[model samples]
Structure formats: C-alpha cells, structure tokens
Target: MIMSHLPYLISAYGITLLTVLALWLTTYRRFHQAKNKLDIMKKLNHET
Candidate 1:
C-alpha cells in the first residue's frame, strides 16, 4: 500500500490506536477493582 503522506498517516493511526487502548485499559481496571471490592464487601457482610 502506498500513502502520499506516510508520516501524518502513521502518527494519526498510532495515536488513535494508543488512545483507544489506554481508555479500554482504564475502564477495565476500574471495573475489575470495583468488582473485587464489591465481592469483598459482600463476603464481610455475610460473615457478620
């Protein structure tokens, strides 16, 4: 494949992909942490 503006295209694609991956990781980490906390809370509540 030939791109007339290879530098610009490469930068754009790299940035876009990185941004998406970062957002996905942030959301996934928050969700996982929240779920872990919720499970711990539930366990504590059950024991009491």
Candidate 2:
C-alpha cells in the first residue's frame, strides 16, 4: 500500500523545504547588503 512509502515521501519533502529556505535566505541577505551599500554611497554623494 501507499503507507509503505510515507517515510520516503516525508524526507523528500523536508529536504526540498530546507533547500528552498536556504536559497531564500541567501538571496535576502545579498539584497539587504546591496541596499545598505547603495544608501551609504548616496549619503556620501550628497555631502559634497
């Protein structure tokens, strides 16, 4: 029956979720870093 494969299915889904979360976190961090750098540059430009 389908019950026999339940564990494998669960593990597969867990791995997929983890992978997606990791990718999202990486992209989010990079975006914030870039935004911060841009803000700093703008502030410096306006000081002249």
Q: Candidate 2's residue-wise lDDT over 1-48, tens digit each?
A: 799999999999999999999999999999999999999999999998
lDDT for 37 in candidate 2 is 100
Cα lDDT tens digits for candidate 1, 1-48: 467689889999999999999999999999999999999999999999
Model 2 spans with C-alpha error above 4 angstroms? none
Clashes of each: 0, 0
How many steric overlaps does candidate 1 have? 0
Question: Residue 37 in candidate 1 has what lDDT?
Answer: 100
The window of 10 residues in a row where model 2 has the poorest summed lDDT is 1-10
- Taking all chains together, each candidate's TM-score versus the true structure is 0.87, 0.93
lDDT of all predictions, in order shown?
0.96, 0.99
Q: Pick the candidate with the highest lDDT.
A: 2
Error of 1 at 36 (Å): 0.3
